[model samples]
Target: VRTVKPELVFEIGFEGINKSSRHKSGIALRFPRILRWRHDKKKEEADTLENLKLLLDPSNLSPDK
Candidate 1:
């Protein structure tokens, strides 16, 4: 196995996001896949962990808006 530094950032698509104790981020993504390679973006420009956590909000998951 080759170990590579965290340099590349990609946009990921997922069916759902949920809180999970099994993950370090305390969040889990269902059916995740690489939507696109963000070549134009730098690693520093990646989405923040807080932003991802926002998806866990109950209001955001509500079927009725």
Candidate 2:
């Protein structure tokens, strides 16, 4: 994750050319400053690989993508 750090994650979009054909992809994220930390939650309860993929599904992301 350090290799991608703060920049590389932005390469992806909820929708668009950036949403490529890879089986698994990483996307850029913003608004983390205003977001809540999951410190109260355990790693098992936090976002997982499957959760990220679920967020990318066409039915999940807003049309603004």
Candidate 3:
């Protein structure tokens, strides 16, 4: 098993993203899994918030459960 740090990048698979009052980013991941470490890439090359938002299903953006 590989452990990821804040400065490292992980290929994660999650069910969805949700609004979160507790997180600084105001978004949370549902049933997230750390699939693997992106060893060939640098941390700076990791996905950004915009990248994540772009991948989100627009209709599912609402926080309502």
Which candidate has the highest TM-score of all?
1
Over the stretch 1-65, how does candidate 2's per-residue lDDT look in tens digits? Answer: 23333311221223322223332345433322323444466544544545555555564354334
The digit string of per-residue lDDT tens for model 3 on 1-65 reads: 34346677789999878765666665778999999999998888898877776765667666643
TM-score between model 2 and native: 0.37
* Candidate 2 ranges beyond 4 A from true positions: 1-25, 30-34, 57-65
Error of 2 at 62 (Å): 16
lDDT of 3: 0.75
What are the lDDT figures for the candidates, one per model? 0.79, 0.39, 0.75
Cα RMSD to the true fold for all candidates: 5.8, 8.3, 4.6
Q: How accurate is candidate 2 locally (lDDT)?
A: 0.39
* Span of 10 residues, lowest total lDDT, candidate 3: 56-65
Clashing pairs in 2: 9-27, 9-28, 10-28
What's each prediction's TM-score? Answer: 0.76, 0.37, 0.67
Write model 1 residue lDDT over 1-65, tens digit each, in one string: 24557799999999988777666766778899999999999999999879998878585453322
